[model samples]
Target: MAITKEEVLHVARLARLELNDAEVERFQGQLSAILEAVGKVAELDLSDVPPTSHPLEVSNAWGEDVPHTSLTQDEAFANAPERDDDHFRVPPA
Candidate 1:
């Protein structure tokens, strides 16, 4: 989990970053600590835990689908600035 100075510089190069000596040293320690913290997960006993996409139980909150009365063609075209019979008219692409 100990990130090397060379690894830090390599990462900075990949990210198109120009890190000074101080920044490189700082990031090296920070990245090492982060990796050590993340490595703790491997030590956990997760055999009894089920694999899930989400940590919490979730369900779709959708309302019942029902048919309803719709506007007529005349009503739909009433506010149109330009119309072409049954469709709204638009400028040619």
Candidate 2:
């Protein structure tokens, strides 16, 4: 699972990254560690475990769908500073 310096350089090249010798060496170690951790996880036995998108139970809480009377056009425009007939007037963008 260990990553090579050449592989790290190749990945950097594909990503259009310009890495110096120090950065390449550092990334090589970091990426190799990540691969080693994933390898350890792959060695685990979880036959009884079930696959799930979320760890906790999920449910949707919806409000009651009730009809209600809305405001009239004149009532809605009562506090407007400016009005263009039935629409509110605004400065040009």
Best by TM-score: 1
lDDT top scorer: 1
TM-score of each: 0.49, 0.47
Q: How do the residues 1-93 of candidate 1 rate in per-residue lDDT, one tens digit apiece?
A: 899999999999999999999999999999999999989987999899776777667788677899789999999999998999999998996
> All candidates' lDDT scores?
0.92, 0.90
Clashes of 2: 0
Q: What TM value does model 1 have?
A: 0.49
- Give the distance in Å from residue 91's predicted Cα in candidate 1 to where it truly belongs: 36
Pairs with steric clashes in candidate 2: none
Candidate 2 C-alpha lDDT tens digits along 32-54: 99999888966879788786677
Cα-based lDDT at residue 48, candidate 2: 80
The residue pairs that clash in candidate 1, if any, are none
